[model samples]
Target chain A: MTTTIPATTTAAAVPVGAGLSMFDPVFIGIDEFGQPVYLDVVYHNLLAAGEPGGGKSGLVNNICGHGVLCDNTRLVLFDAKLVELGPWRDLADAFVGPDIDYGIDTLRRLLVVATNRYTWLLANRRRKLGPDDGMTVILTVIDELAMYSTVLGSKAQQEEFSTLLRGLVSLGRACGMPVVAATQRPSWDIIPASLRDLFGYRAAFRCTSLNSSNIILGQGWAEQGYTASDIAPTNQGAAYLLAEGGMPRRIKAAYLTDTDIYNIADYAAWTRTPTRTTGLPDMGLAA
Target chain B: MSKSSPRRRFGGKSTGTVTVIEARVHRSSARNAKVAFVLTAIIVGGLAAVVATSYLHPIVALLLGGLIGVTTGAFVWLLVRVWPVIRLLWWWSTEILLAVVLLTGWVQLANHTSTLVTLVVVAVLVGVPAGIPKLRRLVIAWSWCLIVRHRLRVCFAQFIIASQSGSLPLILWATPTPVGERVWVYLRPGLSAKDLEGRLDKIAVTCHASTVLIERASEGNAAYVRFDIKRREVLNARVNSPLVDVIDPSAPASASPLTVPTALDLPDVEVPTVTLPTQAKPAGKKSAPTTTANGSKPAASSADADDDVSDWI
Candidate 1:
């Protein structure tokens, strides 16, 4: 069943800003009232899920594109369906895709980096990584995560991926690493409850059923007037975003065309050279 | 005029006047009795002083007797004034002394044992109980409840003093909540909730709280104030943060595979010489510089040692 409310008149547009502090707010989209919504990536791991053609990829691209342009942000892209993330391939510090093994290797590499970063932070008497410390923000974007999991050869491989991903999702926020995973189907097998619980922020587009919406946004969310199933299928970029423990609000992600992606990639390339000279590799983006 | 006629003339006056004269006579008789008692006391005291100094030289005895008399009199007067407080202190000191003795004996026993053995024993005794999650939570919750109660009491006392009111706001309860702790206080009939609202920040400061919220009670004319108590940030519990002792080479590896170092452990990779920003130092270290700067030799040596250790690390 679909339910639609009349959109409010105040549509404040949120523009993407340059710079890589997780504390800096990025424009996610406009709310029901048309006022632009913003969310800071610090201390939050995000999960976005919807049916095919629900504009999930567009939202991910908008967020990732903005993040890639920031001077301090490093992007790690794991695209099981390589076509969606192909435009920004040149911009990402590390792009693994089209094959499941590469994605697994990327996850393993991220786990190692996270572990070492944690150790380095502790040795320096830092509790968590922040933008003020001149540290780089590692933003990992995993698209078609369900497909990536299915491509694993064995259950052990799947479990290993789950364990490492869980560690990154659960523990990565404070170390300036945040994982944003998106999938078309948020089924029990695709995104297990253990994995879903770790994501503090959730965005749901038009989903196949209420159950899918609940799985993505949490239980009782649908009852709480945040029913993603109510969103019309044709509303491409419209979604319900729950962030920073606030109430879920309907928002449309800022659209990023191919040209926009190219421009963001150019900015990332320009910023990469100087950032790498600081002895910290801009490991998340590719040249 | 005849005597009987004079008496009749006096009786003609009001009965109140006759009663006033009788009261004055009764008061004078009481004063006379007090004076008589004081005189007897002085004589008895003089006799005691004489007995005390009887064996000394005659002149010395007189001088010593006078001294003794004055000392005894002053002590008796002071005892009479503050006997209640002395009694209370006497009872408490005895109990406290007993407790201290027992505690000291236990500490001595523990000290006599090897440090390792003592630590192991302590860990077994306290750690076992603390290891149980339910028990640990219960202990934490109970302690939190006590702490909140004490904080609320302190805030209430300060409020009363600042308000300068004869009546006090009745505190129903101070209970913990998910965000912080909440206290229910009933405002007296003459008092306004606004009086407490204005002082919420001062109360929070006194209580060492992060923030305070004052809201009207759901049912009554009381105010329910919530205190967001400040707590020390535990770095190790933070996500993606390393454990407190994780960098120590002697620490054992965690059994969890998630924490086991995988590919990043390169032997030749040098740990960066990252100097932590010293915007804020621990409270203990703030005094170290001043002490060293004063040119105390020991403090200077210790400061040098600290610098050496940091350099080595």
Candidate 2:
């Protein structure tokens, strides 16, 4: 039986203004049993990796869709290919394309914002952010993670970007800023165990081999019968998702067609327009 | 000299020496001190009575002082006796309230109503909450949490190490989760989270759980362990995006200015345009075998059989 849940939160508790809250769980897709699967996006940073044409984009887009439709939510998107996350460009705070320096600059700025938030949190004696704080949730998504980490302009710049990204992933989670990065190449140089472990939630799409699957998910998962390589190539959206402190479970990422994307983006753009007054601040990079 | 010593004898010739036993009344310093304190209080009271002799009769003054001294000692004893019980009550106030409510409620129901009626009422009380899906899940999950607490205690007793007191890890608190229950426990001195990790299967079996994942609950304390007991999986199903219903259809189309088409309505086309070439046949080539208007290929003409392209198609 297909159960249709209307919204993430109950009718009474849904955020008052135009959309949902980042504190609310975002519906990404269904798990293996056809049950609805939602991620606590604010608390969890997701790392999705698989072969080209796999469903990494599908999962990333789901996060982006939910992010754009949220109230008091800021999105910073990096799409090296430019088309995967391009639909929501008009609504994002900063949408970087094909430029390593620009991507590094965005990461550096995001780290600054994260540090500032930590300072605020320290002053208030809070370990993490809460819904009542009224602070914006910054959702930074990198569609092609390998592009900036390995294939970008210069080795020094790429290393700087990786280092800054690692800093953000570590610092942003508690500050209500989470990173959802996707890459086609799941290699050690791109995502070492140190970097991979920083992500609390990881989705391993169909990999060409078990080792690549282990790179996305932690080590020894492939041996434990949770290998993404076992997934058929035809099953594009199927993946083994490992949330922190749990075994990897198979799930199919929810797909948003181009028209759906365009509709959502247009609506988001209308909602975030400056002329319309709302609780959110003027849209830009965080202070 | 041996006879005078009267200490030892040959083993087979004489019986074993019997020692004289004596009783000694050794005074306990605490008892003596208590007695001294009481006596001092009495002496002070007696002095106060002597001081009061100028105002009251000696007999009345003496009685009053004795009464005052006894009352002070009695009050101190009563406090010493009741403090432990009061502390215990304060520690388990909630548990005591629950037990009291259940016992009194059952008694009242049984006294006022028939046995069958009482049973029915009790059933309804439990049924109403259990009938609600969310409440039912919470109740079950928390019930599992309680079960897991005892199961862990059992596991620690049987499978894991215990502290010097032979006491199990203290279950600090528990909460219900979507999949199961999360239990936080404070490990005793002899036990560590690593020790429990090795016996997860045993603990899972005792808790009637499919799986039990143990992790350090607090970064500051290694003894604090969190157990996530999974009896079922929450992520087995394909969840449809809430965005699928984000746009309401019942509302006027004007609210959503851009209409999203749900299904494609393809126009019907003539099959001849697709199957046969649109361009006119070459003038010099043999006339192609004709197809019927229904798009069914007709039998090839005997003369044009070799050049029929439709046969290959």
Candidate 3:
């Protein structure tokens, strides 16, 4: 579907509006056979795990880029590194950076929003949120998930963060609040099977070993010859994507440079300003 | 199940009873065998006596029973023999139904109109499919589906290890895909999707496609597999995100504290070059320069390093 840009009502104002919907399929990258791949993030949670500098961050950024452009969408970003998801922080509803307390607070608020949405859904006799529901899609993207779950917090606080994040991941999907998390450490301590299984879509970037790849995709995937370990070190964005298909598929994630990220973030901020006019139709002459 | 004789039973001897007439004719094993021996015998024996009882004369009844039994055996054998052909017709029922409709439509038109109109209708039928790309693609794809079945059978005969009885995997229905084709296969004993995985490259070559992917079709059954033959590579090239286009050309981006990069990259900075230990210097050749990875000044690739003129510090 085409993104509708609302026209500027005043002569002094530049045309600024975002009408992209999150319910639409978000294009991620291309599969091995050149088929463009998309994610239905509204209904699915995505887990991206790989070795350091393996481009899992690139996949996370692509989702953030899309979320910022969508009109009826709210971004909740958690970047312990800050740089990976830093560009779109200005546009985010809540930006959590190296702060466990803030991250936990944001997640709790998200869970509350998710609960209210479910109540509304039940009252409307609907199973899940729809594009027509006019609800904002609160997309929470966490770069370096291990930081919140392992680093920067005490044991109790870390566990709390994990628990709150899990609750949001579980109840948020059907209520227009989906989570996209990425981590370099594909370990049980960082991401247990209980939490990993909650994500319907898993992208395994270049891993150091078969076991690491298995943790990201599943058991037996490496043995079946669909392993991220086989990806070369030089191939930055290469990954094995698992979606609705029972088996994982080889893919290369789309990339955006820092310049591109900043460019998008700036535009999104301007469009999302409280004073930005909306509900106006374009009446200019045909281009 | 098979071509076994009941006379050679669990311990030999039929036990000499009218239980011979009670031997079941295996209707379920029609596809498993070319002939149903016990079934034919049961039909011959059971129906003959029933037909003979209608006659009153003793000698005449005996002759009638012999004739009826022979007739029953012949009919049963004929059905058992032609079972394979019947299965083929059933498999192509869609095409057969289409042909029937077209033929019926032509006849009705001929009854109502002249010969010229019928010829024009036929011409329209031929032209319409040729004119529409979707229809032509569908017809071609379905045609390939038929071709792929034979190709896959040939591949199995050449490479796929058969069961102890020399039975090959049963090739099932195939459908068309955008990149290539997807075919389903039911493997016999001693065959699994794992056995086919290693031989995918060879299968792709045999199918005249670029590549092939084999996956388990059913979770409960390991023998049922699906082959996805790919004729193109979609991810060979790098994909640039659409966010790049969102930038306004006339207006510059306003960066806040969070909008700035972690490490500010100074654009247009000349990269610092260093002398490497592994530099190969010829007697009269110039030395090449090695550069650190700068913001946009990309680190020279290995080949670029080899070709550049180096400056010894």
Instruction: Give every prediction's interface RMSD.
Output: 26.7, 18.0, 17.9
- Winning candidate number (lDDT): 3
Residue-wise lDDT of candidate 1 within B1-313, one digit each (tens)? 1232345565465333322122333454445445544554476557755786768776776666666656665556555434434533552454568579868856986989988887787787669769998777666655565566556656655454433223345555556543345666666555555665566567667666644545555544344433334332111110111111112222111110111122244553333422221111222334445534456554454553454334335
Write the residue-wise lDDT of candidate 1 on A224-284 in tens digits: 3456786767677778898863667667776666555555544444444444322222222
Judged by whole-model lDDT over C-alpha atoms, candidate 1 comes out at 0.61
lDDT tens string, model 2, B69-119? 666655554554444345436535656787899999999999999999999
Report, for every candidate in turn, its global Cα lDDT versus the true structure.
0.61, 0.71, 0.73
Query: In candidate 3, what are the lDDT values of residues A95-182, reduced to their tens digit?
Result: 7877676777888889888899898999999988888887888899999999777655556777788888889889988988999999
Q: Candidate 1: which stretches are off by over 4 Å?
A: A1-20, A271-287, B1-313
| Residue-level lDDT for B238 in candidate 2 | 38
Q: Highest TM-score: which candidate?
A: 3
Instruction: Choose 1 or 3, whichever is better by TM-score.
Output: 3
Kindly report which residue pairs in candidate 3 clash with one another.
A33-B234, A34-B234, B287-B309, B287-B310, B288-B309, B288-B310, B289-B310
Looking at model 2, how many pairs of residues clash? 12
For model 2 the local lDDT of residue A15 reads: 24
Q: Is the docking of candidate 1 incorrect, acceptable, medium or high quality?
A: incorrect
TM-score ranking from best candidate downward: 3, 2, 1
**Which scores greater on DockQ, model 2 or model 3?**
3
